[model samples]
Target: MTQQPAADPFPPPSAPPAQQFAVPPPSPSGRWQPERVDPLPGTEFGLVQLRVMPITSGLAIGSLIAGIGSILVSFLVLCFGITGADSGWGGWVSGAFTLLSVVFGAGAVVLGLVARRQIRRSGHTGQVRFTGGGMAISGLVCGCAGAGIALLSLALALVLQVSS
Candidate 1:
């Protein structure tokens, strides 16, 4: 005798399927493309928005460079003077380094002050604000310190020279 097929427990629905989110097809190069998604209500996404960065003042950067150079050269002057090396150019080299340190220190102070003023003015004008206020202040401090060191070193050298 032939057996009859078992009755189906679950049958396909007659109604059409619900609508789904549309997705773009892959590119011809077989790379997956990113889908554009709308941000949720009342939410802001930085990636979808243009951002502006504040500009750094050039004078502030220059001040920082000069200040660091002054400090470094001041140390070299101190080392050369303290070592008491009797090389032919020892005194001249030390004097030159000391002079360079003072010059760099002066430049740093001037540039830092100018940069600070420019940054303040720009901030008050409601335009793009300039950054690096801290750098300018630091440069000023470093420049003053370097200049003081050079002056002290020169005084010591002079006193020692006179005593001998």
Candidate 2:
């Protein structure tokens, strides 16, 4: 009889071999050709957008800082003068600071209003409006507070003078 070769247990599938893919020839510059990439749906790509800072931003910040500085100086002078720690110089220093505070406060208020007007005219693009508007409003509030404190101090000084 015979030991016939064992019948192949599992036959291979009869699928066709995969075809080879074709690649484009390299360019004269020896670089691979650039391929176009599709952006994700509902997204934008390409040129970068630039925005201009609002004109009033500088003015507002300047006024706010000046107002705050004036307030601090005036407060220190008032305190030192009252406690007799500053002698006569305190009065002069306080007067100077009070004047500065009032000037800065008025500047801040004016700049804030101008900034608002500019924003309205510019038609709201990017973050310019937000930043400029916020700075302007904050400056206005800070300046008003500083001016009020200075004015109060001035009144108090006048009263003290009258009483003395």
Candidate 3:
């Protein structure tokens, strides 16, 4: 004999097909429900925290110091000029100032070269953010100032003029 069709062929009609969306924690209204979603894929984001922000901070600092040193040398040069005219120990003082100027100038040049190298490196690595370039430029200023002062002082003291 053929069997009769069951009252409900489908599984006892359980809760709505495993709702992709799940019910939210019961709200005061008792009807709150939340929808499910998957996290965004492929698209990603990154931040450049710069563990050490490495554009040779010391080089920039050295450049800045050198620039300021140049201004100091210029002042010393003026002093040397005034002192050298009087002769005696004044000449000695002038010589000292001139020497100081030369030293400071050379230091600034060295620092500038270093800073320029750093700037190049930073641009290559893409980390430097704010002040290295400015400092390096200042170093150039310092070098020029120091050289001018020292040379001018030397010329005055030794009469190295072209004698035109």
Candidate 4:
């Protein structure tokens, strides 16, 4: 025995054929209407545009690292008194390390300035959303402090020599 197709269980008594299952009209703007902006090539979805963006600053990071390292080195020199005048050879070694710290600090400040300049340029071009300007500035501050400390140490050394 073959089974026949079943009719609607509860069809409206006076409903017209076309209006029986009518779909609502589309709105003026469709649900997923994309903006009028032109889509970038190779993208199937026009909702988002892709572009290369710059963010990280290598120079700024280097500056921060160098500046902090210089401070740490100087602090170690002070803590250990590795350059104590008592030891003839230790004094020269300590002075050299202190000088190195000063140089590192200066380099950090210079690199930080360069990074900041690049960040500013990138910002103007709208290529970078965020920048490491704070890091660069902080590095500059540390560098100056390190240089100042070194100069003070040198001055004290000279004063002690004159006193003796």
Candidate 5:
């Protein structure tokens, strides 16, 4: 019996190897590297971008520093013996405390605004470092605000303490 070789089962491959060409890297978008960070890697899809500004970190740091400053100023006033309007030294103490409050309060406010700007510019999505920085800044701003509030509270407490 004549046995024909069993037909080959696999379908023929479609494309030849000669047609493939390596793809070049895309041009810079100007966000990550304005000039040059480093040479491009051989692989694709894992490059990180750095932003001009980060918002959250700013707020965090600013708030904290300012808040502490505010608290310190209030404490200084108390330490200096601020009292009812009867002494010249008391007026100086009050003025110094108020100045500290203003500086801390203003720093917090400015930092908060900066944080918001960074968030907006970066489109709200970024590397962990960038986000963390923004968050730290924000925390600082809040801390400052808290310090200012604490200063006010301390003023009241001091008055009560003196009265009692």
Candidate 6:
């Protein structure tokens, strides 16, 4: 007896197939042209253009960093002074940090000024426009604050030494 193949439980549909999407051929320049897609019914679409933003000044960034470092070192000096740890090696360490704070503060001030100037002059010579004027200002402020604190701490230390 011949074994007949089991009858299929689900038969293929005899309905017409759905439409298929085709990709457009690449252009002569080897770049694929963007395909425009139709929006759904009752939907509105707008063309999108790429926009370029101005770059930030490196000097501004450096200034901000230096200013923050100066502030931190100044705080360290304050902490050491408050903790009465300015004896022997601690004193030397504190002094070093104070000096560092001053240096960093000065550097931050200089860099911030330079960065602001550069930002102002950006795009004048066909160069990319620079942003970060606010950063430069903040850096300058922080640098001044840090330097002031360091100087005040030094003055207080001196006064205490003189009194003793």
**What C-alpha lDDT values do all the predictions have?**
0.74, 0.59, 0.60, 0.65, 0.53, 0.73
Angstrom error of the Cα, residue 149, model 2: value is 0.5
RMSD of 6: 13.0
Model 3 steric clash pairs = none
Clashes of each: 0, 0, 0, 0, 31, 0
TM-score of each: 0.62, 0.52, 0.55, 0.60, 0.43, 0.62
Off by over 4 Å in 4: 1-36, 39-54, 79-83, 124-126, 158-164
Q: TM-score for model 1?
A: 0.62
Worst 10 residues of 5 by lDDT: 16-25
Could you tell me the lDDT of residue 36 within candidate 2?
A: 29
- After the best TM-score superposition of candidate 4, give how far the Cα of residue 47 lies from its true spot, in angstroms: 11
Compose the digit string of candidate 2's lDDT tens values, residues 120-164: 666354444434677767767877887888777766654554454
Which residue pairs show collisions in model 2? none
Candidate 2 runs further than 4 Å off: 1-56, 84-92, 124-130
**Per-residue lDDT of candidate 6, residues 86-151 (tens digit):** 343445545777899999999999999999999988764334689999999989998989988977
For candidate 3, write residues 82-164 as lDDT tens digits. Answer: 55555534455656777777777778778888777767666333344334777777787877787787667756654522221
Which model, 4 or 6, shows the larger lDDT? 6
Clashes of 4: 0
| Candidate 2, number of clashes | 0
lDDT of 6 at 109: 99
Give the TM-score comparing model 2 with the true structure, all chains together. 0.52
- What stretches of model 3 exceed 4 Å from their correct place? 1-56, 123-131, 158-164
Q: Point out where model 5 deviates above 4 Å.
A: 1-60, 81-88, 123-129, 132-164
Candidate 5 deviates by what RMSD? Answer: 11.4
* Model 1 lDDT, full chain set: 0.74
